[model samples]
Target: FMDNSKNMDIDYKKARTFLDAGLTYPTGLGLGLKIKVNGNYAVNLKFNGKADLNAIMNNPRNAHFAFQFVPSGSLELASTLAVDADVVESGVKVSANLHSSTGTDLTVKVLDGYGVDVKLGLPVKKQEILNFHSDVFSVIREKTGSEVETPVKFNVKREDHGGCFDQLNTLTGLTVCGEVSVPLDGFKVLSPAYGPSKASLRIEKEDESLTAYHFRAFYDNKQPDKLSLEVLLDTPNSKTDRKFLLTAKGSMKPQKQLLIVMESPLTVPTTFEAVVIDTELEQAIAAKLTSDTAAYFIKIGAHISGDINRRKYEPILEYKFPETAALSDKGWIGRKGVKGGRQQQQSAVGISGAIYVEKNPGTAYRQYELQSVTLNTPNIKVTVDGTITIDANLIATDLKASYEKDTLTLNSKIQKLGERKYIARVDILPSKYP
Candidate 1:
């Protein structure tokens, strides 16, 4: 009596029903109840009430009652302080935090019947989780707890069939100020017209090198076609991304070809190879034609002779005839004409001859010594030596010059003669136009 009262024995049973007998053959209302009790167990009676036979069962939209009994007296209601962990199902693994009563975070030890603790953040009161069956997504924490993932997104758009397949290629040579765009995909590249889209890439340089290889692929649903990019690296070891700026503009046409014009500084030497082109480069070179209207003509060769300086006489050189014609005008031929005029005209208007500078024989003479002279006008021949002075109205025919003792001489036909001091003659032909 001092210790304990028998545990209240309790038990209960109940039933309720509603029915209609259209023929009035039978009308029914029923209720059932019962009760039982014992030291450790008990049962109780219940009441009958009207029941709706058409009431919906198992309403998933509304809350449902559930109960669970953990037999282990120590029903660890989760570790008092546990970190929330991820719950992965299908192809998607959601990682978030679960906390303990003490606010200590918890981690998932095993998930989906698999080993691997998926850590979690704080639990959300109302959470919506999206799980993709065809695609896979996973989250893993780093040692330093940082997120390191290259995010991928895909989007697609629609276009007219004609706008989809048109393609083009081109070759461009750029100096310091031009660029080209080479298409990498078919025109109507997006499929499902709205399905996942991706940009594929191929990069190259005019001269292949590691610094030349660069590209990126991305999908923009606002754009109907897959995009491509080629970026040139300035340095072989450039570490920064997007150091160069790029923009592209083009059209799918009633305009036949796809033309992509680019403008950029010649930051580096580069070349682009393409399959087609719709536009001509303004600075492009035109091919040379063999059938040109005008051509360049060049004349080059040589004329042979000996040194005029070595002649025996300081010859008086004359060109052309009649003293009116000049050797400079007719060159070598003019000099011949002057000689011919002397022989034929006999008037001695034209003349050319050579005079030798002579010194006193065996005496090392210091002044003018005449060597010899020949004239076509009168066929005059004269042997000269010493300081002999002669006077004649000399029309010098052809005078050629040479140096002896540094003295100058002239040999020619005589129209008149004078003393050795000087010779004065009329119709004396002079040298060419100097």
Candidate 2:
């Protein structure tokens, strides 16, 4: 048996030989193996009678995307039914629940090996459950006793590496209540390249308090040089005093640097901190080296600053003015992005400065709020060699904006707010070049 797997090192690289005496040998050489990839779909072929077969997927090459149509008067109700069956040597657990605006309290557990621990539904003040029971390999639950033997059904969707890891983590979370130790043998067996995946999901509810936490870890083999170990934790509930945090920590072997992100629901967070270890500093001084034929000179300096607490970036630019012998007027252009309405958000040109900072900042204030920007100075004659862009909302009244060579078109709109009141909104929507 030979592996036509993607791993180049493990691929059989031997030759089949048939010779004198007992030298006759079976096919030993691995040949005619190629992997065809198109977008997310991949197929591996080894050109042999015995080959791994997989399901085929449909492609919508000529189909246009559209939303699924739902009738106006029709109503769709979905339920969650999880049936876990166990063989004679193994045990399984089945669970089912119906969701409401509040939450779901129904669950079914089936134990075949040790003993049966059946829970139809946890008694809630107002919630009701039918009945639940499990046989050797099936669990039935419904509103009456006649449905005991009738197996429950539900659909499950999954990704290649996404859903299985979630299931494993949930199992681990159920077993780990307090300080629990895990041995190497307890982990599922995996190849060295694609090994080491663990996850845990935990939830606790009591009276008006509820808490949920999910932990996931998996190997990320995308970055060849950097061994990427994805570690993530999300706890959205604030029932505990420890503060709510959604953490996506990078857990890798080198441990050179780990960006453990602790993000709340809002930007401009209340507080933040960082501890630097094995810092590597890099500095460069840019100097102007004038060409022998050149007569004019220019100098520039740049500085970068960031605020972790607010997650804000402020860039400041100061430059040494070059010789202005023939230059008269000089002006600077600035662009500032404010909150926008639906029109602004869906406009051709998007000018969002910090949309990620706030928790879904209102679209009303997310528009262009430009008081003014200087396009020309008193002495300098500004003739931009290339095309220049300026938002009509930010342009000063006196500044004239016209293209030099290209017929720059503007997508402008005028709206009236009230009687004898109007506002001009203009933007250069990007489209195919003329």
Candidate 3:
């Protein structure tokens, strides 16, 4: 018997750590600091970290409003600043990061009106190294092809970590001090998310070092489907030393594809545990890549057999080495034509493979064999070279075709490819002589 109990699960530890901490809703922490800069610009400061209270914000022009830099192992200061001007339609936004041990970090971003943006880095300066990035997609609207009538729908975009685990809410727009009616020098100041009575930044001795840890996702608010848990633990006697973070995520897609994936953020040595059970197929795969070249995968698939009483099972164990696994290569690239050039024509090549098997209730089983290799582009033609098996006979084919006018025109040998398989099967089937 397999010792499944001995498995090292980070999810178990993460759940206990998060639930014990509890959730805190975003509060409009009363009146903060507001200052006027120039004829067209103004600044607002909000300090929400565990730091000393300062009502008078002097020289509050973006980063200038921050508390004087403090030495390590002292007061924990969590603060942010914002600036606005009539120029560029909106002024640039700058944030003042205050840490308990280290000085402060300043990150500036422009307001491009992209609707959504995700900024990486913890509220505490020390906890920036183990910055967690999770895979959670928010709703985004965009028109696909010109032919399509409406915009494309929202989807859970799967991005293979090129790099963040916690989804950072895009940098917030300008927030004016609510309580006091302090007007900007020139441009109109936009309203904050809360009313004037609320404080912009509430100062408490116990500030959250985890910064942006708690997150909730709901399709219709019945219940949450994704859970992101992260814990940032910093050791004492540290100024230059960076803090560490432990992160793990769990997601359930009950409506689509019936998927449950639990991930442990291991950027250097990648690993994942996932189970996919849907109407058409069922598979459970666990993969771990300890090093660049050494990787292992264990998978099990379930299939219903012809006989209802019997079930078929497929157990697969695969190991990938540095030599055999050939990674995909960068394909050919060249300018097709330029305005004053002689219709510069260039062609390049690449390689790809696929294995697809399909079956219809009681019909012949058809499996799409992997094509030897081909390159596909808008103005390029290619050949299909792959052997397919239909019930009993095996067909070898080399078919060529060109695609134009949004149609694929087959122009090759033997009528030219699939007919050979049907003709061969006809000779074997019994003929009716009248």
Candidate 4:
């Protein structure tokens, strides 16, 4: 009977060693010796060796088995023996076939079976396999304008252990500061059931050096089916290294080897200077500019047009001239705080009119049309009527005025009143009303 138990442990040990040496399974090892007796007879001896599975596994070599035969007693043997190896080799072809769950494609080869020309029984259609890689590769390619096929070289040291983060949420109510770069700025990946929508930026920079990363998706109803990406590169020593903030909503399909699509808003790298809190004087100036009574009133009104964020506006203003009541609620034309009878009469005789603003499509300064009215004494009848034009700087040009049929008529006049403010006036009598 064969001594299977005696060397079983040894074979296992050797196999373990081979496994440690990176050799595959089912490897064999043995030792034998032969002695020549006269010319045609010989004595053979054999012994099985230990199998170190651990060693074979650790090694990078392919796993294999070895066997030896020896004659202990007197035996006669021929110098040459006819051995047909092809048939046996064809039947004993050692190989394996790997199948993937996803549709990813992969190619695998059997080491020993290669030279032997073994046949692989692969499925009619196979899934593809995605090559494992680090995320930095994609980021570096965009940031440095390097091609995707750029030869990148990196080594993992002995001290480095393999690690992974399955799902990360990098942008949870996070704030950005200083220079920062994000490769997947606007990638939107939608779930199979949910509709398409925009994707949010998943990475964020808290301070100058601190950064937080996340893999959470922004939940939305109108997710886009197509994929989108945005790359942010914050250059070193950039002047915009101040209080920065960004709000993005973006999506990701996790199907293996499948194309991932993301959606996001246009990535415009813009910096906003810190809003400097105005001193007491600055606040006072702003208040004075918009406060009541800061503006003057006349029969001729002022035309106003400029860029404002809101679409709705209702300005409440109070006029200061004493005779303004006549031009406004009361029927009188006199300046406020006018002392003496002559001065009061002169203030009452001052010009009064209405203002009109005409905005030029896509132009900076709007056209201002002012209607002024210097009431005739005794009856206090209307008199002047006209229009004026101004540029973006509120510069008045083409100034002309004419009194037609007892009514004032003015031509387009462009004039700069202030940075954005403009002024135009006209006079009109009841007969001129149209």
Candidate 5:
């Protein structure tokens, strides 16, 4: 008899024992013994030879015991029980399967097996793992030509502690570094006019408190028919508004160049400048520069082609004012006068008609014969029809100026005496239709 009690009361005389011996007591004898505790016992055995046992003894208090066993090449037994007791509260509880394990799995839980389940040794397939090289190469081939064989090298590191905030005590950080190549020829299908080029991209964080960053993208090409473009983005002082800048330059043909620059700021208006130059002609054929609050100026300059006489007689020309002028309801206005006096005059006058230029016989000076030109000032609603001749510094005209319901005919000769000084002789006929 085996007992763990300090006191025992039993009658040996009343005890009985029985046994049976088989196989004539010579060949074989079989014996079996079974014992059970009075508390709670749970045993789960599977056909694959895995065993799970959970037992709770009710002596003195609740005591838990559990274990799991799996028969495999790597034999391992795992405990599936956890005991928590509080002496001050005098609380007792029994929990089963608080932890479990098998040949390829181990799981643990707390708080009566309903909280914080942590699992380990979970099965994973090969396909579930990421293939870095293959994926990167596939993307590169898709962007570039399929014949590309560039090697991609990268590394990944896991940091145990990265960043933290309130209520979050642990953080994991993953850092990746790599490089990818992009062929410029791949984009030819999108824009055939662009020459062979290479592009570079850069990005940088400017501030930690604000969402401000600096970005730049540049594209460059070879010489002769060269092209280049750059873009920039930033915040001026980590406090001001964001700003963006773009500049583009291209030289397509001989002696021809193009330049463009644009700037945009969140607090102020945008500004831009564009120019197209022909170095052979030593001029810009078309140019523009302006801002939102500034005066806009545009000029188009070109050389007149064809017969010399026709070029001189029927020339097309453009003119630009030296000073910036403001556009108003009454047309462009010049600078304001001093002390509120008369406003300075401003005009953009264009003239086109048949005109002749001839050299005076035995004289170094030339004469200009204006055959027919009609000048009109739409803002003032006045029209002038004139035939004039300019010889040396003298201009002689016989012209008619017509206004609303009035026409005046004048025959005049004006001679320039000095800068801003002129002497004139005029004969004005009475108003014809006043």
Candidate 6:
């Protein structure tokens, strides 16, 4: 029954009716009807599925919410909201593709034999800001029911550029605890080739009492060389919280010298100390020369000070030799086929020097000046002063060595053989006196 009047009222005490009808109404349904009938009424209604009751009540505009329903004992609901996520468990993996607005794609994978609790969500519309809570790690641990045992790999790619990283925004509030092992192959493109098989990174950021981030990386390999790096940022207890320290232990030869380049001025104390193989005095003065047997007892210390913009370096270097017993008994430094008796034992050597480097804007090389470099031994004392220039991986030195009543001019050029390998050729000329 249809009514065209503005107001209609129908009253029924007991009625049973089964009706199936489709209705198309205006925004406000411009009519009012009162129903007082009640009893087993089965009515199936279908709308355009774009009608919204809230929109029609607030504003009789074109707003809509399409609605269609069938009366049934069991009903199922479905949604089309897209989500990006990944999970790894018990050798089974599940992941979803990520959508990036900037055309850059990122893939994060947890390597095999490991598990991770990764949660991600994106809004229906793009937003600029992303915030993370301080307890994110804890939340992840709680969800996974255990700590992560392997590293989470990150691969970022850009269609327009070719590099390890491109157009990536900075992420904040990220705290990682426990140990995470990262493969060295992931950073093969970086400079100063990494020789370590793996790098283990550890960070302590869960402690609320500490305001700084304590991070450390241990680079380990089967070779004799080993490295450990530590960094502390925003530490409150120290005078300078931004501290970086690197310590290495390995053989000498190619790895004899440590080079540190700073892009900005450092306000904290930065030091480098290494325990390396001891090349005899001859090998120490000339790189190409080597002893038959080498010992790992030379202690080198260097305090680096310089900034790249200024192009000037002034570092203090000091070398401490091992005890005479170890040097002589162990044959750490000796001439070939020379049998040393008790009276022919060798004496310990001590060296202390400073190096100054200045780069000219017009020149393609930098000059290192050795100032007041003294080498003292029980047999002889020598003073060295020289200017060394390095260009295209070639190191050339013009220096004067004075000992006793003789003054010698030393000219040497060191050539690189391979990775962490070098050979120095020296030509020593002496001036004759009556």
Q: Return the lDDT, model 3, position 383.
A: 42
Clashes of each: 57, 15, 13, 118, 0, 9
* Sort by lDDT, top down from the best: 5, 6, 3, 4, 2, 1
Q: In model 3, which regions exceed 4 Å deviation?
A: 1-223, 235-239, 254-273, 278-280, 290-294, 321-434
Give TM per candidate.
Answer: 0.12, 0.16, 0.22, 0.15, 0.28, 0.23
**Which candidate leads the pack in TM-score?**
5
lDDT of 5 by residue, 206-311 (tens): 2333322345555667566878676765533445445567777877676455666677654344344444555332233544444555545444443332343323
- All candidates' lDDT scores? 0.25, 0.26, 0.28, 0.28, 0.38, 0.36
Q: State, as a TM-score between 0 and 1, how close model 4 is to the true structure.
A: 0.15
Off by over 4 Å in 1: 1-311, 317-333, 337-354, 358-367, 374-434
lDDT winner between 4 and 6, please give it. Answer: 6
- For model 5, the superposed segments whose C-alpha errors exceed 4 Å read 1-233, 236-241, 246-258, 265-364, 369-372, 375-383, 402-405, 408-410, 414-424, 428-434
Residue 366, candidate 5: Cα error in Å is: 4.0
Q: CA shift at 205, candidate 5, in angstroms?
A: 18
Residue-wise C-alpha lDDT for candidate 6, range 166-214, written one tens digit per residue = 1211111123222212223555423111211112222222223333233
Task: Tell me how candidate 1 scores on lDDT.
Answer: 0.25
Report the C-alpha lDDT of model 4 over 291-345, residue by residue, as the tens digit. Answer: 1222233322222233542111111122334333333344223334444221222
Deviation in angstroms for 364 in model 1?
A: 9.3
Query: Model 1 shows how many backbone clashes?
Result: 57
> Tens-digit lDDT track for model 1 on 181-213?
222246633221222222211122222221221
Q: List the residue pairs that clash in candidate 6.
A: 49-66, 49-67, 50-64, 50-65, 50-66, 51-65, 51-66, 52-65, 288-424
